[model samples]
Target: GKVIEGTLSVHAKGFGFVLVKKGTDIFIPLEHMLNAMDGDYVSVEIVKKVPKKNPEGRIVKILTLQNKEIIGVFKSSKEGGSVIPSDERYNNPIIIPKDSLSSPKIGRKPKNGEFVVIMRTGWNENDHTVTGKIIDILGKPESKEMDLLLVARNNDLTIPFPTQVNKALTGLPEFDLQKELKSREDFRSVPCFTIDPESAKDFDDAISLVQLDNGRFELGVHIADVSHYVREGSAIDKEAYERGTSVYFVNNVIPMLPERLSNDLCSLKPNTDRLAFSVIMEIDSRGIVQKYRIRETVIRSAVRFTYEEVEAIIKGKKHSHAKTIHLMQMLSLILRRSREEMGSIDFDISEAAISLDEQGVPYSIRPRERIESNRLVEEFMLVANRIVASHIAKKSTKRNPKPFVYRVHEKPDKESIQSFLDLLERLGLKYQLDKEVKSDDYRKILDIIENLDYKYFIEKVALRSMTKAYYSTKNEGHFGLAFDAYTHFTSPIRRYPDLVVHRLLKYYASKEKDKKGAMKGEAATLSKKLDSICTHCSEREIRATQAEREFIKIKSMEFLSSKVGETYGGIISGMASFGMFVELSHYVIEGLVHVSELKDDHYDFDKEEFTLTGRKTGKVYRMGDSVTIKIKSVSKEEKRADFLLV
Candidate 1:
């Protein structure tokens, strides 16, 4: 058996995969997992290799343990029963000792089928049992609010500030508007405004654009100065660091900061003297940044416009800021053109906007409408973040680069890119593959498929083949954005990395005047803390994204459950040996139509072409092929759907 080390990704069905660096991920069956938890670093031993399928592996050792909160259903007996985990990824049942039968929250024995949380004390290798005690009993989810509570507990997200955080909040001052305005650059008179979603409450960033006398444009991107209020090492800052970023659900949000600061104090509210860290850039007519300055400023936002309102304004509704909006749109177009020319890969995919009723039942699902107004704001923020990152990276050497958190996306691996190219060739679309893949290669293919009927199918594959973006202290350069350096600096109210970057920028700016202070081992002290911070923030970000995606899938399944047996138009979005996934028209909901359900004849799967064809009937199913389907079954708990081919 050949041994290899990689992170384990467990599926809900108990099977798992270990993704090594060089090839397709190795598979591990349910019995071979060795009780390894999802997301655990493990050593896997390859036991069998099957052509056209991933190699099968057995877990040889658990390299690292994940201290995760446990939630499960309790089954009690005299000798200490067991708990069945709500998450199906846990292959083994957890044992609850007789003394652990009594719940701490209720101070009573947990009845069968009651949802309870457990704290794992240790694993009993002698008995091969995972031992734990019941910590809290979450009563059965009888209502939508209780369901929300269950979701929050599973994800470790909570509302209202902690006691220590609130205590630190009291120490913050009620800034004197007069005194604050005198200490920094004043942008109160500028026509600055915020554009965000209609449901947005915490306005973090605002923009001010002016046509300079020398014919260059002055663009001011002002972000909320959260660091000014929440000092480093404070309780509030520590809590924010733990959160990493805000988690937005279908009906609620777990904010990174308390509402007092997120929505009121640090928010760039209109007609208020708000503290801001501004990035002022001077750009020529061709969208080239001529010069820039970073400064702490006091800004009074003039208007807060929603994306819909801005779109309406752009379509000729009369308003005082209409001219500014139009100019910003013109500049955004130029910026986008320049970015595309620089080989920045833009994946133009439509995000699903799911709407729920009062009872948290999803009733409507559609693509989020993207307009010129959205792009205008996005372009400004991207430029500001890029400039902030480039300023530090360009000035320092590779060995002594400033210690900062960067939003980096590394280049795609050759194996994944080769698979994608093979798929393209199978579909009869050919292109020359360079020795090394660049962002521009992806950009060119996406442009070619922009108007093709199979655009969605191909684009999804290309995106899946790319590397995930994460936070890192090293500036490896962002492959997707085609930038020499990049960092997030636009939304400190929602993101912790942005706040840390703001503080670093200010600290370095001050030290520029004091050579001795700048040489005071500041880099060494900061560098020691950065790697862990970046890793934690990246992990939190992935967790938040997973939670958000889970909620959407659950809601989507619930919606589909209502339509069981109802026929709808669908397209084959994905294919596997056993089944094909069909996505409904005008909806992002996908359901698996198993090969067994193909009634006419026995089907054979083409692994390379991803085609399922009948032996006798000659019926073929492939990616991007249209077909009618009916919902056969759906499981909201498992977040899965099955469909019948019609």
Candidate 2:
């Protein structure tokens, strides 16, 4: 029998009813419910269906448990302690085991107010409650930062790498690193340079270009050869694979590889010999790649240029190195042409990079934008990666295709795109929504919004209407980059997928041409496993993105904490019955302006028009409307920013 699927509705009393599929709701008796709580997906067995009565069903099994890890404030009665979960959906206070509780490490235990991470152990249906054990005390609930706790709890992240994994990394034998460099091609004579952000520690990729005798350019994309340092099946390799990607929190970075490899040996520091997997691309002035080669190379970087420095060079700043400046100019022009020809979506999204002082207090909130130097590195990497992917895909020796992990981006959902189209139509923007939206279409939209005085709100809405790119075994190509095949062959130090691709590329290079056909079976098996890893990596990417957003939100609130009652010009980003979200002009920090504070007339939200309209007055608060707002309050503990209508 097919078990009915529905959400469970529990009450403050000791019982709840399961709303079964389209039929009458079933009564899950308090005792018969076992450990099932509200909002749990339970596989229920239909016990009885009587006439004119609600169906009675017994829980056969628990399909899924909501809220795997709970974050809450700890409170202790004389008998024991319990956690009041942060989410109101699970209002039940979970009892904490006494043995699992310990006194606080830093100070006298927060007897009745410390925050902690609790894992649900069991639930008592008779009491309509959940029982959990305090795994670890996070911090004081009133601490300046509560966002990290929320991030860890929401993602069920565990601190401290496994002991065995740590021991493996510590006990690994040091390879003959110096001797291994002898076999690689030496690029010490070339004027290789690294372009990165000023705050960056992990330098992964470097570029060097020279005009060839045949009027073509030889562009070298040298990546940090992480595979050369971290041996296969080693502890470091296993740990890197498990992490999949680095986690970037507000003030810190939990890297994929250990510091010894990622920040030291694998880092392509200037004026030092470093191992690299090099891609030599022969491209014409017309931005066409004529031929390319991949090789094991050793390079000494001559210079390290920040994005700011590169941007200066592009703007014809009188730099000492004339040749490098000219190359930068040529590269930018080439990239612009390539981007347009490929219909690549050139978007301008501001990333909030907070500046912090020594004691971890927020100093300032800065918005970083992509400059010409950023595009210089981006274009070279794209050319390098495309050459690698195309080269690998073109080989026809094997029965089954060679397995390489690719960064794939699927097309956006039609319904979501249509919604954005409808929004544009309402805005009176002449965008062709009925036709397929390509990179060119995106470029045109960006241009349209850029020229308009109210471009900020339009771009914000446009951003909300797209899909995120992720890793996959099957290359659907990258829609954003407009590449038929794309793979992450650079930045192996930070990204795990790139490391995997580097290892695969090296393995292919090591094999004899005659034996390539025989390697298909093993490659196929790895491809299947790589696919699973891609999904896991993609999910982790989402988690990382959310964590980054949460950190930014916290920093944004802190930045405005000092400016309470200060009024600033803001644009409405979102609107709801409760309040409207207003993004400040200078800082771009969005805070809620509660509806209760809005005087003059009662405003009702119109869902169809996506606006809050005053019934009595004709004033409207639409998505892109600008308004004056005063910072009312900033709550670091609550992770919220509140504003008042001026």
Candidate 3:
């Protein structure tokens, strides 16, 4: 028995590789890798394979298996029932024996078009199949919220908190009701307000800005003090740790905390006495931070403004609260200066938002925007995060200062960056990015993209070349934010990290004796756990994103199901030897344009550029290139949609 330790990297074909120590990845064949799925840790034996081409292995020893379960589409066969798993990486299906059926006869099932969650019972090595029992029947995947539910289940996301966790939230300390807010700073008199989307419930941040006598401006970044409600080691805290942040899907949101906290108690609702962790900064006309203060305060937001109202103010049109239009102008200037001095990359990407009618059918997809209010709140939050991170970093020494979690974004892979640079060159853009390219250097690339004739193409390429940011114990600095020290401290109502930051800050803010040391030790423990939490949260976030995308895809397919033979403008999203994926421009719906459907001529895949090139006519369909496509076939059962190049 050989012990191999590594992360499980899944392949598109359902099989996966246990990426062992260093770059050594051992292939876990579909048959032998039992009780092991994607993201699982397992020990494997070198079952006869040469090292040169690829190392293959068999699972002869089982050290530990991840308790993570998967949600997928279930199927039944003539020879009994089994699940044809939906995850592309998990190639093999779990076969449910005739006797394993819960109630209905093994062969008799839901009209051949339902979805189910399969519980992995065991695996049969000889037959090379996974054994499972049908645990649930997630009726028609085409339903309104079924796609979201399936995606969540598939991504290992628990849509509802466990019974125990929910019950534990009852009878919480009446800290909010107790009028012990005498000592805290009262900002209720000030005209502080919240600005968020119309549908937003978790209002984490509020803003209050006023000009001082000396011409300097006082700005407040007030965040919901969720730490005041969820104590350390509490069930809610543990659950929040498990779910690092709330996952917002197309139609619903899987909240990090319960609705009582996220939407009611901890939310910065207008005209309500809400506890908040605030960052008050005094700045001159030039956006220079003159003085800053971090304090736990009580706030009652005067009003709530939507992004539309703020946009109206920015456009110089008279809207509600026209008196504070000057503040909006000042914030605009501050954002401009921050972008200029910080070299923030200007990346404008469109997001698809679904609108459904009474029948639950998607009526439209409107592009979402980040209006002036969004930017104003963003700048203030960034300032607060930067200040808090800097304070923590400065207070902590090189050897052992204070332990704190910092959001870090490492440099993108050199190869991937070079590839993107090469694409930019091919697109006839002039921008130099080499080994010395820092965070600020991204601005040059952004500038080139902005100036390019094909701005969208260049922007897409640039985006593909960037690395994602995540929270961590070690500080590598955030490359995207152009910050030396950055932490998320302005969304305690929604993000667990923000709650942690609030707890640490309030602990240090306490004037009472003997409380400071215990807070420091607790903060250290949190700091140490940051890395593990970072990885878990990052993985969960990705899973949630993928699930959302899949749900959208399903909805798109459902929409196209009734429109077969209808043509629409589309962009090539993906390509393979068999077919190319085209996303409709109007609805952002994706479907496969099969190779055989190219009636004009036979096409061959250009591997170098990832395009399908017609051999005879020289027509090419490449990623991001626009073309017209007609829906050919759609099957909600198979979860597939096909299109033909028109």
Leading candidate by TM-score: 1
Q: Write the per-residue lDDT of candidate 1 for residues 4-115, one digit (tens) a residue.
A: 9998999877899998878779999998887777877788899999999999999878776666778888888778878888786895888888887776566887778878
The positional error of residue 341 in candidate 2, measured at the CA in angstroms, is: 2.5
Which pairs of residues have clashing backbones in candidate 1?
Answer: none
Order of the predicted models by lDDT, top scorer first: 1, 2, 3
TM-score of 1: 0.87
Put down candidate 3 lDDT per residue, 1-646, tens digits, no spaces. Answer: 4556776667765576888877578887777766467766666777666758557877654444455555566666775677766666665677777666554533435446577766677755565356777767777766677767777777677888988678877766546534647657777787788888878888888888888899888888888888878988888888988887787766578989998888888888888888888889888777878899887788899888887777777778786567675585676577568656786665776666787676568767756666666777777778888888887787676454566678888877888777877766665655676657676777777765675445665666677788878777677787877878898888876677777777767655562334443345655676667667667766766766777777776666666688888889877877899989877777766688888888788899976677788888998777778889888899764568888877
**Rank list by TM-score:** 1, 2, 3
Comparing 1 and 3 on lDDT, the stronger one: 1
| Candidate 1 residue 89 C-alpha distance from true site, Å | 2.7
Writing each residue's lDDT as its tens digit, candidate 2 over 216-265 gives 88889999988977877877778777777788776677688877777777
Global CA lDDT computed for model 2: 0.77
